[model samples]
Target: MESAVEQLLHSGTIIPAHPLALDQYRRLNENRQRLLTRYYIASGVGGVAVGVHTTQFAIRRPDINLLEPVLRIAAEEIAAAGLERPFIKVAGICGPTEQALAEARLALKYGYHIGLLSLGGLTAHTEAELLAHVRAVADVIPVFGFYLQPSVGGRILSYEFWEQFVEIPGVKAIKTAPFNRYQTLDVVRAVASSSRRNNIALYTGNDDNIVADLLTTYRFHVNGEIVEKGFAGGLLGHWSVWTEKVTGLFGRIKNCILEDYKGAGALLQEGIAVTDMNAAIFDPSHAFRGSIAGIHEVLRRQGLLEGTWCLEDHEVLSPGQTAEIDRVTAAYPHLTDDIFVKEFLSQDSIKKLLLHA
Candidate 1:
């Protein structure tokens, strides 16, 4: 299975950390969720990740039994999509070593390719303890390190931690999303410093710096020589919302990298506009209190969501979030794939897609 993770790193592109859909019952919305998975396939993401923060993992953890059922539905839909390349499936794993190991085993049992392992919950412990915990989970499934931003329950991880983490046998990738350039570079340097440096893949989860992240390469001095590397791709929550356009941006960036279109100096040179819209959608003004809500609101307008319903009521949009969503959607109509979402929102349309598959 090491070859499987290696394969994803080598050839796979964007892997959206997809959002979870709940029915009016506040339980899993099977059909609508399946439709969302198919939409990602048609929109062109090379992989999909569920059971992450954006997928409401916290709420699902209490009733852990619910997690696998929801995941099974996603696995079913991904199998039905029938793409030319395999859509790498990533299941999120968090909590204590035992809990994370259980989830990792579940991911492997269901044919998931990797576990997006989170270390936030264990921040209170020593690095050695955390490393032991991580190794325990790695024993079950190949795990991707998730250095999430503190704004959303993620704890800060030191360079020392990452230096040792990359040495772990089953740690195959790292999703650097601390949103701090210094922290991001720490993980990059740590990976480049490792014995498995060439084998480990680094992915960006920095929604605010997506274009720049994908466009830049990192350089490091290790073992008396210079080493260079760049993010293999992304596994982002932001991509879950504006999916179609995100996929297109991915294509443009890839073309620029492949053809050496250095005439403009940087690929998608005018990508600031996308980040500007992110500023609004991500609600930087309110310390991102409305970030998740903003994404839900955007999906609501596209008819993908019935309303902005989160697992917890307080998690709903903050005041004025809707206006921000409205402003961004109108300001950059091209960024919203509402038309594409609406086209398949109908039950009949999804049925046809499934029938063909």
Candidate 2:
């Protein structure tokens, strides 16, 4: 494992949403992207995951191709931020093996450190086929396996699939975001059982179980001795919203773990408020119609976003989602770090981005 990736992967990573100009649909708002990168770096997040689902990868089609531009500007923004610690810049990779590897190479060219491989485009694939796809991509650069939820068009992988995944050369990490306990454990167990177990880092992408997942100490016998394991950290869409506060919470949790503090119950309890806010935003009632909108609304409130607009008109907040956002903001006062982003917000940039607003 590369020392840089090993160092950066051992902490929480935030996935920032692509901020569009207030009224312009499908536009990549570069100024806001810079500000977001600045804020995320200031908040002490260990890394950033861009071009992922949270950034609405759906918009990066062959015609428009926002992927390269977004990654380039983000690198520029990171240089502007002058961060001391190296941030793990991640590029989300999808489609077939050839396309995915091409994207991975582009990401590396644009200063991204790892490819968060999403096997969404290759539908009706077998485990062997998927394994081949990942190995081919990994041949070019380091890779992270993603078990995205079905709700978001993510194909669920079996433990058998994960076991094979962990053994793949250059498969450096796994983001377990199945949104199901059994599936989450399947990935964890796969890592635990792999011959290259020590070489692979496990990160939780299970937003609903973020805190508990971090607190858990998974014990298993990897060799003659009993080997213990746990998630090194998280890479979450949920973290994009309340970022600074979320970063602080992550620090506190990690501190407790280091000190072996006995307040596991209280630590897990803190997740409920965040989960409540997630429920409102990720509203299961509407199948998350407002999920992205709800995220934008939070950022808009913080001045990280220009407005709650999306690429597709129907991508706007679900009905009553604005009210739900309001309710969570009121109910979870401590959960927000709006002032953090607001403190450094550029009204001049906002005005330039949205002339009529």
Candidate 3:
């Protein structure tokens, strides 16, 4: 296992447009192609976020560095499952500064081509320090600045904040969950107006308006904060619900959004199907674990893993909740019938689930 200082000091050169990176992008394209083959039309792009906690078991057993190896295993598993282009985000809200940085570093070193950084903890820092951190990580991996929703104690980053940070050496993307549609669009406009055109990507994490926002050039806001135009992609948070189903539909979803397809609501419904189905299985009483549990619960039902672990003491979903999860999967219609749950559910259970899946 690489020490933190060793990992930090090793200035690994990023191969410019490396075959591996291009291969990854190509693999994503292939995944889309497979989806078209499956449905005759592309759906939307689907990406999954594998939490670090899920990999703890693997790290502990192998005498490996906890975060990096886990991320590598998860990425390989996601790719093997036909989600060749899974977007991996470090479990930011709960991770410490060192852990977050190490995870991001491992993500770059391993196959997780994209990185997510927390905006909540960031906003607490001065703009200068925040930009410095963003620049530092961006140098190694393509980073998507994560702005968690306000409900999770998130904050609003100003246009100037983005203006400065976007210029950082390696920063390339922004993830904003504007509580309201207005604020959501505002983030879109801000990214569009930024100096970097195609270089910088903007992803609206506000699921409610993402479909509609993609159709228009400008992201509209209730506050009348009609910002500049921005290209949309990278639905990092949406992955928990639609991981496998998304493999074959991302292109369709992108086209639907761009073409202003009429059945947008239905599209949302289709995407929401996985989330809703999973939610029905674990919600309310299981809220103690919060949405992270929802992510694990969905993965478990999909046969990704046999069990889950709550990172924090307060976040554990009750045993009754776990039983209910099993019940939900048992009762789920065609979704669970013959689906093979993958072995690389986490670092700890990788060998087990991989053998089974």
Q: Estimate each model's TM-score.
A: 0.92, 0.92, 0.61
lDDT of 2 by residue, 77-141 (tens): 78776766667888888888778888888988987778899987567888899999999999987
Query: Could you tell me the lDDT of residue 210 within candidate 2?
Result: 83
lDDT scores of the candidates, listed in order: 0.79, 0.77, 0.45
Deviation of model 2 at 99, angstroms: 1.4
Candidate 2 stretches with Cα past 4 Å from truth are 11-25, 346-357
Cα RMSD to the true fold for all candidates: 2.7, 2.5, 10.8
Better of 2 and 3 by lDDT: 2
How many residue pairs clash per model?
A: 0, 0, 20
Best by lDDT: 1
* Cα lDDT tens digits for candidate 3, 93-160: 12435555776766656555556666454546776776676666666566666666665556666667
Instruction: List candidate 3 stretches off by more than 4 Å.
Output: 1-65, 75-103, 122-124, 207-231, 257-262, 268-289, 318-357
